[model samples]
Target chain A: MTEAIQKTVQPIGVATAALETKRLSAWFGDLHVVKDISLTVEKNDVFSLIGPSGCGKSTFIRCLNRLHEETDGARVRGEVLIPGAGKRENIYAQGVDPVSIRRRVGMVFQKPNPFPGLSIFDNVAAGLKLAGVVRRNVLEEIVEISLVQAALWDEVKDKLKKPGTSLSGGQQQRLCIARALAVRPQVLLMDEPTSALDPISTARIEELVMKLRSDVTVLIVTHNMQQAARISNQTAFFLMGELVEVGPTKSIFTKPKDSRTEQYITGRFG
Target chain B: MIELSSRDGVRKFSNYFWLAMLCLLAFTAIAPLFFIFAYLLVRGWAGLSFAFFTEIPKPVGEVGGGMANAITGSLVLMGLSTVFGVPLGLACGMALSELKKSAIAKMLRISIDLLTSVPSIVIGLFAYALVVVPMRGYSAWAGGFALSIVMVPIVARSTEEILKLVPASIHEAGLALGLPRWKVLIRLILPGVRAGVTTGILLALARVSGETAPLLFTAFSNSFGYRGLSAPTASLPVQIYTYATSHDETWRQLAWTGALVLVFVVFCLNLVTRILTRRTV
Candidate 1:
């Protein structure tokens, strides 16, 4: 673990960071999964968290949305602040509504869960409808635009009425992306979004992620190191529930500042 | 040397033996249903007639009327029961699945299970005492209330089980969209489990359509047709009981026809539910 400290992190401009965690630590039962970790994600930038399984990467992402509400002895001592649409707002305050934060910050799971019961059109419009959009024509337009933006319009435009589960694996993942985008969330958190897909499907999603970075800030947790190098502007490396190092993607790969990051990157100790 | 005691051989034999036993059990269980159906048709078919459907039952020795009033009575009572029962059952099921942490949800589930286990006769007595005694007379409404009591538990249990079967991943996806809990349940979870809930409701309807015990004290018996909910009603099972025990063979024949009609309606309900589910699946 000591080798993790020397991993090199590229110095990037601080203005890009949109959300920052001061000193976040999360626990499940007696097990401390995420131990005093802090990281920053820039607005309209892609930040990839790469680590081995059971390294607290997934747990860390779940905490951001309060999905695994730290109600059962699960506590976060540090501050997680996201710049408000106008003014600064403390996201980690006790009085803050998790639902409101969740609206601005959305999540996509590892599998291609496309709400099997709903049609493709409804799948995209689900978030909007939930936020109380009732007009049919407007919903129709958002559905079309979201599907198009997710790069899934051409394939499913004809069968918008079909069940979302009818699509192929790659298209289903893209549909999930479209569903997430429909609500117009500012930040998107993806947990191993392509881990369940085939190589070709993975590539298409990878391409979509790159395209999405221009509009929404993306914080992804992935096991694929190469994927981090290819898509993310910044990369954070974790090992044994601790963030070993974080830096620009290129610097993290070529000259890691931490030895643990270096060992893990070189396939020495995952 | 022969290797009869090998692990692979032992595993193979045991697997095949279990499979054969399972198949035999399945066949044994299904065979009785066919036998019962055949028996009913044989005895009940001879009673079929227009008068059997349109007329009331006769007295001790005379044979002139049928079970027409009972048939309509059964339909009206079941319809009323369904109108009262289905929505409440579905709502309770939705609440149990979507609101796992609420105290009301837990209590609702417990009550539903308790209601289901309550004997049919007890339900009849309860309804008779509460509804019939209150009105100072037996009425179709009392019977419908009893039937709805039975229907609610069955529908609620089925709905809960079916909603539980819907993948949590689906709910998570909806929640990820920032949808409130109720919207997630109504729009996403409910639709996913719709087929199973419908099947359960049909099964409940089938149960109520033929029930005689609960309605005995509630709806009582009216040889003539009822006008609506407030009046005494005729139902197939209660009327069948009334006719089959009489000395008149004509009344007995009419009773058989009523029985046959009840069976046909239940069978059709089951068939439609199956076909609907199949199409959706």
Candidate 2:
């Protein structure tokens, strides 16, 4: 089963950056939130972003999926490249539809936001339906697979018809992850996904993130430095809208690259 | 210690006094609804019969009559109003919520507020000029148009408020799925606020069902059944107004019956809205 899973998840070509951003900056009207910063995320890598409150980590991840500019008066000026079907495409290029870009990059929010109106099955099937999949058997199969991948299938399999919001906070968050995975996005962006959950739920989500690294590149924003150090292979530290440092998670935590990074990791100051 | 205890006693007394006052105020507000319902039942129950619901009104001096025409006409008018009003109002509301920071949205919000405050009678007059005059007579279409206008602001304002209650994160989640903006709105945000939007629409329908002033000049009164959308229609509220003010005792009784039926329908709609909202939440 493990070998089968690895065969399905392993990339066809030599591993390269699945997502690359150049001088990405975002502003909310007159307020410049994300400063000019560039970063690259390797294929199948679990990359984590860590920062204090209002450090623009969330904004930076939102920009990857074109969700940041959805805000009123919010604007992003940057080049985001994603590996398209056969070639790489610049997401910010003219005529590139944000809709298609979003389809390629799925996102999970800070809070569990299962569609309150839909059944658990339907919640997972939403993106598939959006992609125009009409066959019932196909939808059922995909929904089940996605839920299993999110580690939520065992708990919710018997009550697929129940409302999505009926689940516990942790289950609902996993349901959201399932919903995101249903679309088979190349990149999965999560913004503080486990902050609202209990410790066990948080641990479950952390385990799921590790498991997901084999299938899709995972980019997560976390306020918990320990969470970043635990799951992520590559870690980026941001402070006051700037990328302070980026390195292997072990080096960033143990070896001091920058005084600010060291201070933040040590619990001296945020 | 004495001073502190006395001050606490005074504060506690004031709190109880305010609670009593608030309860009294609430009862005062609710008292008239019960009294009106009781009076309607007493006045209207005796006139209700199988014939009262299925047969047309009798000629003058007749004792037995029904408001069959008025009931059907009210349904038709309400249906027409809903068909015209719901889609337009929902679209306006979605636009307002999506483009909240735009100058156009701000202007539209202000205009919708103004429209809500506009009297139903003035809307009837406007419909008179727009639809009635063009057709050369009062019409069910004109009446429906007036009621639809009245419904628009209520639906739009309530929808905007309800959609606004949905967190921005939900919208981002949908957008991040790569669905187009319209699809995100129709599939996600709209479904998220389904109960609220339904409640708003039902409330608007209930409000318009009780409106007599708008139907007065637009639908006018027909003693007969519906003669299509272009013809003058007999709505429950308008027929009730026509009959209640007449000298005949039987007509007045029928008017009371019509009022009772109208109140019942409105009450049922409100109940359904409440149930739907509760289930969603």
Candidate 3:
């Protein structure tokens, strides 16, 4: 058990990299959605990915957790490295389990998808329970902590027994966040998680994303440039399945190195 | 405005004419069902009595008897058929839904479709040849095996369609949580569609219980008591057929009440299935 835990843990002295990609590319059948792109997210950085519709930012993050290949006729070719056996291991390696990688790298989708059949408490504990953590007391404690981390604890703590879907749209999204956090992921991926919510709800999520940085590295894809400017410390610009520019969020907004990045961010053209 | 006004009168007349015609046609479609209900209620009301629920069949030409054995036999056959059919049908459906474009699924789909269209009587013959001849007796085992053949296709098809109705996104959510494929299915997917799958099983049961031709040769008919799964067993449909065709007036009357009871059971099953499906939606 200790060996297993040590294997998943990173070496103490190596420079911390929560997520890194090496020439990662993906395709849905013959249509390439994400081109070869190498990038790194420092541990605890709120990294934002900004792009136009169908620009492949969503597909890129999906590949990070190996979720892209789950689609019918979809395929990925790349290297995604996270902690494995006391070092950063390429997740796409032949023997690596995608499901195991996903547990370590949690995701919150664009639309809030709380398991409708479960209560709020069960929704947060689903990952833990599925991972073989079954004791009620252990589940209760982890659920409360995760909910508090997602900033949804106070609102839902009293009604943890209510169906997860009964919550308001924003609350539902936060519930999903809490669910993702319960498993203690080292990196969290948000695939335009606020696009389906109202401005106020979006504001709450943006705030939560910033606060989440204390524990996990965050990679967020968003159509809203202002959201990236407000919440993210670093930003990567993508266009036509390729990364155009990446830098500090302030610089990416104030002065982009690529002409397309300037045009797209400046509202000249997408 | 000119274009809209030019055809307004003609369009209005066409719309009203088709609407009225369709309403009449729709009523025509449903009229026979109400007529059947009224006819059965009137004809079968006299045959019902306290004895009908509590007593076993009194021998032929006798009065004041019940089809208690047949009722219990029908329940047994339904239970046996459900045991034999539901798990296999559910497994078939899961395979069909998961392997959408596979060659194996295509073949399985075609086979199930063909099985559904096969006459129930032919299924009885199949069970007769497969079980009756081998076992050298008509028994509840043969009857249930035959009825299960009639059930598998319905359950499999409905389960496939119902499982499909659950959006792919919900399934993906489970997978994203790092749950294994089977865990996601049992914990997330199946529970989400529990009512719907139950509706399919109930529908299959309704059809199975009402089956007359399939049980004719497979289960034969008994008047006294259920022997065992390996013994000839009585059933409501077979009993009704025998009573209806008998020379005795009292037997015919008993047949009407037996049919009424069977009809009520099927109607209740259908009603429950409807409610369950509504909950699923």
Candidate 4:
């Protein structure tokens, strides 16, 4: 059974570097939230950032989308790049619009805030709507395909008219995923997406994450080491706002090169 | 047994003490309403007639017509006030909620607070000097301008409070979707707080509906039905004031009817707004 599972889970296809950060850091006032963190995400792969609370895994993930800007004397003297037009686009360029950046790199927050005043259909179509695609048929197709991609279409197919917030917590998170997918973004960021869910819901989201690896590059921030091992192809462990180690999930768990990685994996201290 | 009795005695006395205090506070809040309502009902009772509604106030000693002129003028002024005040107030509220850190928002907030605390009588005088005297006469438009001054602050402050109550997570969600800030506010944030805005508008309407001092200087007193916005107009509260002070039995009765109508309209508006807020959430 183990051999068969290994064969089925073997890295199926080629991957490309989708996003990379060099010496990225975040700060609030004078306090460093994420320090000198550097990592890379490849296409069609699930890369998980995991650490204890205040270790800055979430901060690092937020920085990828430029959510946590270094304000009040806080500075990030690094580069974050996304591949564009057969080359890399430096996202930190002075004139680049963060709004446009966010459209290409979508994020799902920790709590399921799925545009409470909107219908389930509209919630999925928010980004497209924002980008000014008002065609009904096009919106309908995108909403359907995105929801299916997020594995939530079967449950919400008949209730597209209902408010998005009416769904259960797990379903709401999936709806948020679908909402992000509606824009057909190249990279999808999830910040503690399953921390607010029950165990069963968390398992379902993990399975969904694994499935989504084929369509969009995924980078998730999580506190659950077991979840990282289950869903991610690669795991990046963080400590004190620093990227301590990053490698294949299996190796990171079974044979970590760094003592801190081993300590964290073995539950010695976060 | 003595200890048990002593414990029971302590509990009973404390309970009674709290109960008495609660009752006193409730009574303190309600006493003025009870007395004023009772007074209005008794004194305004005789003026309750169809003629009372249709006639215009005449000379103090003589029988007059209903407050038809006042009623119509009040409706027209309040309508104009709502139109002028609600949107500006809502826009100010949106600015405060969405652009909280901006310098203009900070300045506008201070000004709104000042506007809210400025007395209604002062607003009336300001309108008279700014609008009525300049226009060379008291008119429904001037009255509306004064009422809107009172309304803008109430609507703005209440709207700001309501918008603030919406969770910041909602804004984050919109920003995450890559929607521009303006689009997020108009599409997502505003709809979420629609009920609150409506409630504020209604409350503002109630406030301006009963104001007598402002209209005294702006709408002044139109004994006969004025035909245009440029001419002086009568309103219910002003009619109530003039008639209630007169010795004529018929004038006083007409004032009672006008009072009843004004109170009923305000009450209905309040009830509907409350229900709307409840249903929305």
Candidate 5:
């Protein structure tokens, strides 16, 4: 089963960098949370960010989509660039709308948040409707495709009309993934997407994330070091708002250069 | 051992005593509602009939009469108030919740709080000057306008409270979906708080339904049924006030019937609101 899955989850042949951030810094009021950091993510690669709690890993990914600065007192000073239709576009440029930036980058939160009042089908269709796809048949087709891609179609096919909250915790998380996928974004950001689930659910989400690498670049923030070593092609370790080290997942786990990275991976210290 | 046992017995006696006392206090608080309901039912039972709902009041010496005009008039007045009050209140509430730290929001909140505490008679006088005087006569428009003012503060505060109860995470989730802020509010947040907003609207309606002071100087009840929005109108509260103090025995009996109907309507509204809000949460 594992070998067959690995064959299907092979990387799409795109070696160019999909996203680049230069000298990125963020602050809430006067307290700087994400210090100066630079990173690059390759197209169709599963990149995992592993760090201790409150280490600014989540904040860094949020900056990629401009969601970090949505808080009242929050501020960001950085250059985040994404691949546009034919050119690289700076997301923070004067005329660029954050809404458009967010549309290109989808996010799955730490907890499953399928809109409470919406049905299973509507939850997946919400993004398309917002983007002005009004045809009923179009919405149905895209919703079905997205759910199938998220690996939740078979379980939810007969109960699409039920409220989103009626699903189990694991199913709800997959539903959220479908909701994000329905928009067909170029990049997917996950903030500890499996921290709230059981072991079986966690494994299912990790498998789905691996399969998703063929279509979209994945950036995941997780505290689970084993998860980072398992699914990620490249892993970045953050400590105290700084990127201590980043390298191929196998090398980072086997022979990390930085003492902090080695200590954290060995369970010596957070 | 005897001394310790006696002390324990004393403590148990005091605990029972306090429990009984609290139950008595709770019963006392609710006793008047039952008394009023029972009195109205007993006094108003004979006045209730098919004609009472379908026919207008008769002259002083007539044997058969009804308060049909007052019933329809009250409906018109309350309906108008809801149409104006609910939307304005909801808008103000959204502003207050979204801009909680802004100076303008603080000022508006204080002003609404003051408006809520202002005497209803004072509001009646203000409406008398604002609408009745300008229109050159007392009319149902003036009455509805006055009741709406009374309703605005209640609706606004309750709406703010209820909207605040919605989790901030929901708002964040909507925004993260690339939805514009307005779309998030309308499509996502509003639907999430629908039951709470409905409850606030119903509570405001119930509050304004029995307000006699505001209508006294504005609508200035007419003996005939509703003529038009520009003309004077009769309402249950004002009609009951007029009949209860009259010298005729028949008018006083009809006044009790009007009171009973008003209470029943408000009771049903409150009951429905409670059920809706309970199920939503």
Candidate 6:
């Protein structure tokens, strides 16, 4: 696994980046949240976004999958490009359906919201089932693989029929990850996924994210600097609705080019 | 330990005093309902029999008869009204909730709220004009349509309020899964709020069960049960009204029994709603 990942890790021109954003900005009515931001997310990478409260880190990633516009009066003005059916296409282009965009770019919210009234197995199979996958054996196979991939198969295998909310806090978050993974998304975007959990659960999620680099590109937004340093290969620091700095995790933390990034990282001010 | 002063003593006295007051007010509010229920049970019990559920109402001089036809009519009207009312109400509620700030949604909200307060008799007249007049005859379909008018505003308003109570995150979760807005509302939002939605529906059903004014003009009271949706129907409320107002002793007694039956059916509907909405976990 290490050798295979090493073979593909090298930046091959523009092909390695799974997602690219150009001059992307978002607003909720008149309150601008995500200012013009441009960035690239490499494939098979764990990219982390870190910032203080109200920095638009969450809103920034939400725009990647076209979810930000779901907010009332929210508008997006920029371009998000992702590899489409054949070539990379701008997601924000007119006539593009946001539903199809979301199908390929799955998201995990900060709170672990498993579909209420759905059993664990059903929750995992929800994406495929809603998209018109009807075969029972196929759903079962995918559900098992997703649960296994999320590292939750051993704990939840016996209770696939139980409600997804019946699991522990940490387990529910992992189940959501499993749910997002079931569709085999090209990119997975997480927004503060571990902020609400205990320390142990947070550690488990961080570990799971690291292991996930072999399968899906993970773009995670977090409040914990340690979590960002631990899980992310690339880190972007957001401040006051703008991208302050983004670089390799080591360089950004050790010697940030921007003063605000340095201050925010060094725990001086946010 | 703190010392017990006159202030402490007064605090204890006021606490008991308020608790007693609240209890008294609560009992005052609820005691009349139970008393009325008991009165109905005592008065109506003697007239109730197997015949009341299986036979149609007889003429004034008849010694023994029942209101089976009226009971069946009520059921049919409820069925038809539900078919007409529920989907429209749910769709309207979902739309209003989703696009709450839109001009059309605001207009719809005001119209529905006004409709809820409109007299049932006026709605009866509406059904009389819209259905009975157009068809050139009073029929069960008209009655059902009338009841559905009464039902729509109640169901729609309640459904909107219930859907709004669901956290925004739940809806967002479904959308994040790549489901369309309608699909999210169907597979996720609606299912999560099923208990609330069912309660709203049952509320409408209970109201329809005892509706008299609308059915009086639209259904026009058949001697026997309706043969088809196109024919005039006998309903429980109209039968009760007719019997209760009649000078004959037997008809008056039958009215009490019909009233009892309507209340019992409504009670059962609420019980079923509770059972259906009970938490599975």
Against the hidden reference, what TM-scores do the models get?
0.89, 0.92, 0.94, 0.91, 0.95, 0.92
Error of 3 at B10 (Å): 7.3
Question: Considering lDDT, which of the candidate structures 2 and 6 is the better prediction for this target?
Answer: 2
Docking class of 6: medium
Alpha-carbon RMSD of each model: 4.7, 5.6, 4.8, 5.6, 5.6, 4.7
Q: Relative to the true structure, how large is the alpha-carbon lDDT of every model?
A: 0.84, 0.91, 0.90, 0.85, 0.90, 0.90
Q: Give the share of true interchain contacts found in each model.
A: 0.53, 0.71, 0.50, 0.57, 0.45, 0.57
Candidate 2 TM-score versus the reference? 0.92
Name the candidate, 2 or 6, with the larger DockQ value.
6
Clashing pairs in 4: B47-B253, B47-B254, B52-B66, B54-B66, B55-B65, B55-B66
Candidate 2: list runs displaced more than 4 Å: A1-15, B1-26
Better of 4 and 5 by TM-score: 5
- Candidate 5 chain B — worst ten consecutive residues by lDDT sum? B167-176
Which candidate, 4 or 5, has the higher lDDT? 5
- Local accuracy of candidate 6 as per-residue lDDT tens digits, B128-232: 999999899989999999999988988898889988887788787788888898888887777767878888899899888988998889997887776899999
lDDT of 4 by residue, B162-181 (tens): 88887877777777777787
- Per-residue lDDT, model 2, residue A201, is 99
lDDT of 5 by residue, B69-115 (tens): 99999999999898888889988888888877789999999999999
Worst 10 residues of 6 chain A by lDDT: A7-16
| lDDT digits (tens) for residues A83-198 of candidate 1 | 67665566788798777777888888999988767899988888888788999999999899888888999999999999998999889999999998888888899999999999
lDDT over C-alpha atoms for residue B47 of model 3: 81
Best by TM-score: 5
Model 5 spans > 4 angstroms off: A1-15
Error of 1 at A121 (Å): 0.6
A1-270 in candidate 5: lDDT tens per residue? 999898546444223778878789999899888988888899988999998898999999999889988788999997888888777788988899999888889999999988878889989998889779999999999999999999999999999999888999999999999998998989999999999999999999999999999999999999999999899999999998888998899999999999889999999887
Q: DockQ, per-model, please?
A: 0.51, 0.59, 0.57, 0.56, 0.52, 0.62
For candidate 6, the per-residue lDDT at B29 reads 97
Error of 3 at B225 (Å): 2.7
Give the per-residue Cα lDDT of candidate 5 at A93.
80
